[model samples]
Target: MARVVWHVPVTTSGTGSTTALRLFRLRDGRRCAVGFSSPEALVALLGPDQAHTELGEPALRALTAPLGIDALVVDPRLVAPSVTVPAATQPAAPLAPAPICPAPAVRLQRR
Candidate 1:
């Protein structure tokens, strides 16, 4: 029996036929491969627009191992709300430059 899991698919440039699995980052900045048990699980966290593919556990591990990603996050939950920026109608004005502060001088005395 195959332990099938859902993974987000990332299309490669140049050759449209080639594709790759999307890797995610952990809270500690470590790269990890994310998978979901079902399509509904994937969509719940990544939204319905996310493209996905079903693969076995071994296959997912084999694909990500070479990329230095040994950690696999399954059915992970979103920690923060997704932020969406509104489109700007007009070009906004540039912000003022930050004020520069001079560092204090330190003198060392040799005994």
Candidate 2:
């Protein structure tokens, strides 16, 4: 069976969070396995990794009809880069605390 894969860029609703959707399509199958680059985002929505779905032919057609999806998934246009985390995703360094001054010692008088 022939299969097609696509990486579609998407943004979450009202959150401005951006990620890519990984779609796997099989010519003879009815269901598709939907995946995302950020698993955290998926957990936030579905609370699990169950991302598969079955959309009918019309729905699938409508999904790709506008984007000219065929062109984007073709060879030569898609390139897989080495897996590496971008600087923006890295954790920021913890801030250092300000130094405190010592209190002066007082002399005690005899009672």
The models' CA-based lDDT, in order, is: 0.81, 0.44
Number of residue pairs clashing in candidate 1, backbone atoms closer than 3 angstroms, sequence gap of 3 or more or interchain: 0
Per-residue lDDT over 7-100 for candidate 1, one digit per residue giving the tens place of the 0 to 100 score:
6545464655767787889999999988888888888877886778888778888989888889988889988778999998999889899889
Which pairs in model 2 have colliding backbones? none
TM-score against native, each model? 0.63, 0.23
- With candidate 1 superimposed using the best TM-score fit, by how many Å does residue 8's alpha carbon deviate from the native? 4.2
Give Cα distance to truth, residue 100, candidate 2, Å.
24
For model 1 the local lDDT of residue 4 reads 62
lDDT of 2 by residue, 21-63 (tens): 3444445533343433344544554456434333334444566
Model 1: lowest-lDDT 10 consecutive positions: 2-11
What's the TM for model 1?
0.63
Candidate 2, poorest ten consecutive residues by summed lDDT: 70-79
